[model samples]
Target: MPRRASGPRLYLDKKRRQWAIRDGANFIRTGCPEAKLEWAEKLLAKYIAAKYSPPKSASPPIADILLFYLKDRVPMMKSRSAKYNVANLEKFWGDKLLSDVTPANCRAYARTRSQSAARADLEKLQSAINHWHSERATLPAIPKVWKPPRNEPRDRWLTVSEAARLVKASKRAEHLKRFVLLGLYTGSRAGVLRTLEWSWIDLEAGTMRRRAPGASEVANKRTPPIRLPRKLKHFLRRWKVADGGQCKYVVHYNGQPILRDPWRSWKEACKAAGLVGVHPHVLRHTRATWMVQRGVPPWQAAGYLGMTVRVLEATYGHHSPDWQAEAADI
Candidate 1:
């Protein structure tokens, strides 16, 4: 019998000093330097995904569907959570086939992970299968990925004193102080603040836009421009002057951009402040609750927070002094 055919594989072309895909007799240059093995592997994976045309009635391995989406979609997501979620999903479901995505298996997966995390992971898994089905015309059908019940929206928010203590405790890390202040004042999500740059801030105009100029908007993650509060405006001016030309991101550490979530430092601040169950996201809730308690109109607050009035009323309305007032009076 003739030797069995081999699939395309990564090969370092020593003479060219670049990575290439070896498909039997042909060599496809990957344009990645020999030192960047990760990039070369990703390129190989993309090439494999592009060539994959599953036959109808075939059940594809869950890993292939995930790798396809990981290569194509996750990079475009607004938050890094998708990448992490996909990674966890891959570890659990990579060995399983699409046909294995049964309710029982999903429940088993959830049992091993936290409710919120498992739900998020399964959501990504569902998206990956959907994405795969959309792209592969030869695939018969997509399998359903069961997800756990979503956790209730957290009701935690900082009191004025707690907010003060957090701010004071954050004094140990200037970047963290700026992070807490920006979160409380602007009501922007922690991800938004991590990606915020000096160019988005207009000290002269007294406004700051969450979205960058000319950037495409991600679905459901709107970042409308926020009018700068006077106190926040003052702090921005001082921070801008202090940052000089050294840093680009508004919330950076030691003149370098924060490439990852600063949760460790945030937790440390919470610990020092004598607070528990507090995280960066609570700052957004705190700001919204404060506005509701102070009698800010829901419409105004919603616009300021880049959310819909309905959402504002649904999530934070209970904090409003007038909430259910007529019902209570009866």
Candidate 2:
């Protein structure tokens, strides 16, 4: 006696002039005509075989896992920083298998990149691998990666006189003065300020928003409204009225967006100002330090500066007037 077919039943749809496989109530169209019933039958057989095949026991390669994470997880993230880290990770370990990312491999990567960068890459990789393992249950044990010691936060701050000199020297770079002033007063990151637009500024409310409308709120990176200082508000009011109110970006050079790094201009201004090793980020450090020294509560300052109170205290606490007060009391 002939054995019955175990796969889906194959039939031709007269109306559509196509062959289809019927599995229970579902009919999957094969797009083949009735003349190709043999082809449709073979395709159906393969599909049945695949559906019944046992699950693979081996863990996916690191490259495959990273691809999955980027496709499925990265899109859901509100923070662009994760995407940036993933890009760097892909560049470093695009071809490596998950099992190959041992501690030695991590150390090798650290040799090529900075300690902090290497740590971030490894953490991302670990998270991706763990996620894959959770879904597939293939890996017996996740690979261990070495972590570098955290570096102390930078302690560079600018004095009021130095800041004034820098601004005075930035006279040649049309927007550099305003940019410096904003950084000094607001304590916002250079990237955030560089991308800031006039639309996010509410002069009437005496505040400036870091992000634009409809932009994703970056994780742990709040775009809190920065209350304008009296000096900054006065400068911005005059600057806005002077331009005939027609520019889009808050920081522009000759009406063009200062999209690229203004390193050369900044260096020249620093030289003229007699300031050494001054960078745009140092302005953020300076502002935070000044806030602490001037007795601004850590919580209030952190909110205004778009950082956590822990980070504020960790980095700028030494500048706080209350720093080490308990120790002195003892």
Candidate 3:
């Protein structure tokens, strides 16, 4: 086996007085030290060319971007998954003007949420704030808010027995049963389930695709799918829909679209299940962790769950510590 390249690279075609770029993937595949170093040097030169290039409109007020995000950018979004971002952003940054929306302010907002008693929830908020901040702009020279250097991902994993109980409890909530089971089995975000249209599910292939936010409601967008568990497939088969897949969910309430925050139901379920403070996201965390605990690869878990590995580490990694630590044992 050969060593992998550390990063991307650029090559100087001095003979032609030009530069050529090679990527991390290429150098990684080559797996030679010289190739890796060559790639790194090229990457450095490319970085010099790309650095300090200001946006056409420098310093657009935070208020403007946020307003654009909310009134237009957010509402127009078709994915139910993205609504969570809107809601989270509203919870944190809704009241402030864009000029007041410094990276520091975002960090402070995350910090405040992190200060909550839910050891796991605090980190969840920090991670989410960071996600919202990661869009297009270059990071600020100094963040007004700073994330403390600590790895305190909350423990949201459910024991198999606990999962069984939650699955049993879900039966009592007619509208939410399938949704809860989907969370337990698939570990997808609640928002995605809430806004999922029948159009998104590829029944034959057994995949649930995601349509990223900001695309047209009728636009041709592609969201990768997850393989449907057999139980989930049965649930979908028995599931009824209106003439078109226009209904709001895989489950419903009062024959109208069910619209309730999942947290409320999760809380009630925890109480009934003889548990406490079991956040809805915790259910998601638990499901993903179950995969890792069972020796599933993080990359597989991440792709199935639609999160990055960096994210899996910071958010769901708490449960995998023992598994990860055993590399020493190996």
Candidate 4:
């Protein structure tokens, strides 16, 4: 018998009168033995003359790969957004195979997420999809199906007096104090800030690095060192003295690790300062806005804040003094 040129032969189980061997991806054998037998006889004759096909390796099933991610990867991720991502995926693609996840399917998922019952959840799904595609090396091409809803404009920056008051009121709250100071000085994201360690800080050099969640211990993927403001040097020097010899983290409360969620403490800090609606993450925005207002370009401000230029411009630029000043001057 000669070799087949393509896929494996679709065999007809003539004795049982059924078709066998269906590859889920690209090849499907008809269940009717009558159809397969008629085709098989033609194929056997062609094989005798040397023109038949052989089977190829099928890629791993998408559903199995997704299950692996949910079971192993999502649980290991440190970001707060992981749970919501898992939920959105379960809503739309819990059972779909990886090969079956087409661009259209992704697009449809995106569309459904846009009109999601909750707006916050809509963005959550977007990030989840991005995370999913970024995680699985083998996946159908991701499709852009929907644009996120416009977020309301918010000016969450603390006034200078408010920051001073918040800091003073937070004196009794050690971690919040350190977190606020770091937020004011480093302009790093809340996610990266929560995970920063003393090991990543070069005290003498007055610099700290940003590390995203889920990056390998050995791989500081996407995290790069950022130089601290010269103005903050004196404050850190004093902080270091009080921190005692050395610790695994630069920030702590009574020598204990801090919670990743700063909302409760942040709200408390805001209320103590007689301000309302302030979020811990807003301190980051405040610093970045102040920098750009002080003549720093969006690109430089973005790098300082661990954000992209586009994000820096879009989200914080409106609050920039320079932007407002320029508009007034124009």
Reference-based TM-score of each model: 0.83, 0.75, 0.54, 0.60
Clashes of 1: 0
In model 2, pairs of residues that clash are 62-98
By lDDT, is 1 or 3 better? 1
Choose 1 or 2, whichever is better by lDDT.
Answer: 1
Clashes of 2: 1
User: Per-residue alpha-carbon lDDT of model 1 for 1-330, expressed as tens digits?
Assistant: 889769999998889899999988888999999899999999999888678754433577887878778777887776778889888987889899888999999999999999999999999998888887776544576678889887877899999999999999998998999999999998998888888999998888898989789887765767888899999998998898898878989999898878776888888989999999886899999999999999998889999998899888988999999999999999
Question: lDDT at 47 for candidate 4?
Answer: 44
lDDT of 2 by residue, 1-330 (tens): 976655577878999989988876687998888788788878888767545522434556666677667766778886566777777878778887767787788888878878888778778888877767776556887777676777667787889999889989988887887788889989988877788888888888988888877777766777787788888889888888867778878788777888765788899999999999877898889899998999998899999998999988888888988889999999
Q: Give one digit per residue, the lDDT tens place, for model 3 in 1-330.
A: 988865555555545444455555542222224435665565566454443232322344443334334443445555454445445555665555434645566556666554432223323333433433555343343123344555556775788888888877777776667777877887876666666666677778887765533543332332346888888888787675332455655656655655665666666777778777677776678888887777677888887887777787677665664746777677
Candidate ranking under TM-score, highest first, comes to 1, 2, 4, 3
Locate the minimum summed-lDDT window of 10 residues in model 3: 116-125
lDDT (CA) per prediction: 0.87, 0.80, 0.59, 0.62
Model 2 segments more than 4 A misplaced: 1-58, 75-92, 134-140
Instruction: Please name the candidate that would achieve the greatest TM-score relative to the true structure.
Output: 1
TM-score of 4: 0.60
* Per-residue error (Å), model 3, residue 125: 16
Query: Relative to the unseen true structure, what is the C-alpha lDDT of residue 2 in candidate 4, on a scale of 0 to 100?
Result: 72
